[model samples]
Target chain A: MTEWHDAAAADALSDDEVMGLSIAGVPVALFRQEGAFFALHDLCSHGAARLSDGFVENGCVECPLHQGLVDIRSGAPCSAPITEPVRSYPVRVVGDRIEIALNR
Target chain B: MTAMPESEATYVVVGGGQAAAWIARTLRAEGFAGRLVLIGEEPHWPYERPALSKEFLRGTGSVEAITLLGAAQAGEAGIECWLGQRVTAVDRVARVVTTAGGRSVAYDTLFLATGGRARRLPGLDTVPAERVHTLRTLTESERLRGALGGAKHLLVLGGGWIGLEVAATARALGVAVTVVEAAPRLCARTMPPVVSGWLHALHEANGVRVLTGTGVAGVTGTADGIAVTLAGGGRLEADHLLLGIGIEPEVGLAAAMGLALDDGILVDAQGRTSDPRIFAAGDVARHPNAFAGASLRLESWANAQNQAIIAAKAATGGTAVYADIPWFWSDQYGVTVQMLGLPGLGTRAVARGTPEAGSGCWLMLDDTGIVAGAVAVNAARDLRVLRKLLEDGRAPLPDAWTDSATPVQRLPSRPNVGMD
Candidate 1:
């Protein structure tokens, strides 16, 4: 089962920016790129680092701790030293608020 | 030696650390269907070493958290691992590696990613093993963590990255720490003098008594603690002592094979050793670095993974050169310190902001105004931009970079359109 949880204000993040927040007590990283919103688990799949603290470039987010690249839209690892994919969630902006669908 | 078909060729990687693990993974990813064998002396799977002195030492990270390649992943990737086995000899002519257990594995291509071992201070044989520690492996880190759990005062010899990180972790655990370094400044070998001063201040501010320009004359274990005599005739006592001088590359097998070695096994831009069929990477391979303008054997986590990937690709019929700008980072006391390129090659140091103020970067420019290196403290975002500028051989005017009104991402650089 999946439930949509309100994450933040639609205007809270600028284009090509990422913000980390908690929904249902689970850490989630929300990114806005080219006016589209994408969300993934906040933690890096390889190390104990927050992906939100990483740099977003191209179509991927670079892990600040190890420089591993993870695809933003799909949460798939795009580079070496990272083989596992981070969990991505469905995000949508509704009524001036961004909501993420999380499977509990 | 007989030439085997590509599908039947056996590739043997001797090492169980980051480099070896990556080599195996990359080989499989590159669709090398031949036999792959990975031999590592450590019993555990391949894992990153950065957390040994930080999270692992603080008991906040687990073995599972640091593991890079787990058993399930390795098994699925068709990698054969010989754990707890040390390579005793390498027959270059025969293309076979003999382990200490008398198991010999013949290979079409051999990779030496032996990495290194912690350099121990001489003349400490008299001290009890329980009181003195040197962290290089998971077992050593875990042992030291257990000791730190009950310790009140910890004495650290050598104020390099490992020593300082362990000291910081100990302080975080409410233990008093003292660090002694023979150099004039902390991390003097790699860091600039100004950055060394900043690290000294950071440690002192964190309640760590840092003794630069100091050396250890002797160490003796007492009934309840360890006593260290300074080279200048000063004495200090502590519940435990950690030696974090540096690492010595494991080059015995390489040397026995008569492979060219300078400080470490000499490798080309493709991570190819003296022999055509054998390759070396990671902390054990001294390869030519374009960024450093010299042959360097980097021990950072980035080098291990990057170089290994390059070696794996080159070994599997791919043309990839290992020429990435040398990058390294350290986390201490809530601060993330990152370095790109060779800061030692800089003639002028340009400050973007006050790094000591928590978030800033020091751009190291050469005499020709090229960005030779950079040191970023809690400014990883800027460091990413600086890495690109360094790679492009581009540099913004010092005034433009230093100006706080301009963002780093928007900094303009002189294009090298026609420059040779």
Candidate 2:
């Protein structure tokens, strides 16, 4: 089952910016890579570095703590330090408001 | 009816380290029925490096744990274990290897697992066997352990992993220690900036003197003790001096054989050197990596095993490529510091948890949007997952670096000598 959860306004983040927040009591990383927006669970399975605190380039995010990289859309690590992928949520924008489905 | 003779395969291994031991084991496990000859300069067998700094130094893990071969075991495997002999040279053209003790051993296939030895500080003259020490070999470590209690001023050279570890141990023993490193930061070659900074703080907090960006001018012994002069025009009077600068590959035999050497015996993806019958692995061999598109020399315990796996398979008819991310670990001030994948600083650093406050992981990112490296402190479980991901072409999360700034995390205090 899929349900809508309120996220943030589309203009809240600048293009290529990343913001971390919590959804459904789960820590999450919100990213704006290229022109797309992505919502992923914040906690890195490998350890404590927040997914939001990682680096982003070429449509992927790298954990700053251990240098493990994850894809913003799929929450998958690209290499090293982090071996596990993070969690991803379904997202869409309604007018100026952006919402994500964390229950999917 | 006339019958022709069939040539029997033979296996020859060089080195007295763990990699050589494991390769020989793998050869037998793969069901190879061939004559095996293992030659080593040391009279003893294989040993583990992890213990060399800890219990082995403390005289707890006996020589048996460090010994690579057992007579009964090798006998059962039908292996010839050569001891107390040095390989004077190798004739690659003739497929023959000779020992200084006057014996010529021929081989169908060869494995050079020749490991590494402690690197000497150039300017510092050799110390009288008693007061000066370096802790790469079990023998030196064991001797140093006994003198640990008597050291009033300990001047340790180098700020790399070995230096930090020894400092931590000396500090734990309540011995005053001063570390001299010429680099701007400790472990400058291997770890990131933040990690080195935290270590500097950790050692200083423990009352150890960590002088970075400083060089040791020279060391001369007087009637009182050894005088350690610094580059910045200072002097350190110490009872004992321990130099842990680094290690160098033991490639004397390889060079004598003229096996197309660079910094080490150069090998291809399959660990095959210029002489096809001769292959090298572990710290002694510089092999090409398809992933990095360059030749690399690896000295970590993990690297040794991984390289040995490749050499063994190739020696047994498997031609797998030798390529994997380099990883290394060290324990300092009770932190299990593990580095996965090689990384250089690229302006992006993410701090998970609080390393300064104690406990967390660090991720260093590069411009390519891939994780160049990941560092974990006191987190081995997570490192495994991260290690696996990197191996599978996966990187960690992409974002800014962070930490739990609100509160400090309390960790289980570590034993003084527990880290490797």
Which candidate number has the best TM-score? 1
Q: What is the C-alpha RMSD of each candidate to the true structure, in Å?
A: 2.6, 12.5
Model 1 misplaced regions, further than 4 Å: A1-15, A19-27, A32-35, A93-99, B1-3, B415-420
CA lDDT, every model vs. true structure: 0.90, 0.73
Q: Give me the displacement of residue A64 in model 1, in angstroms.
A: 1.7
Instruction: State the weakest 10-residue window (summed lDDT) of model 1 chain B.
Output: B411-420
Best by DockQ: 1
Off by over 4 Å in 2: A1-104, B1-7, B66-68, B345-347, B400-420
lDDT of 1 at A96: 100
Quote model 1's TM-score.
0.93
lDDT of 1 by residue, B1-420 (tens): 336677899999999999999999999999999999999999999888999999988998999888877899889998999999999988777778899999998899999999999998778888888998999999999999999999999999999999999999999999999999999999988887778888999999999999999978889989998999998998999999999999999998888889999999999999999898999999999999986778998999999999999999999888889999999999999999999888766667888889987789888776776667889998887888777676776666666888867867687777522223
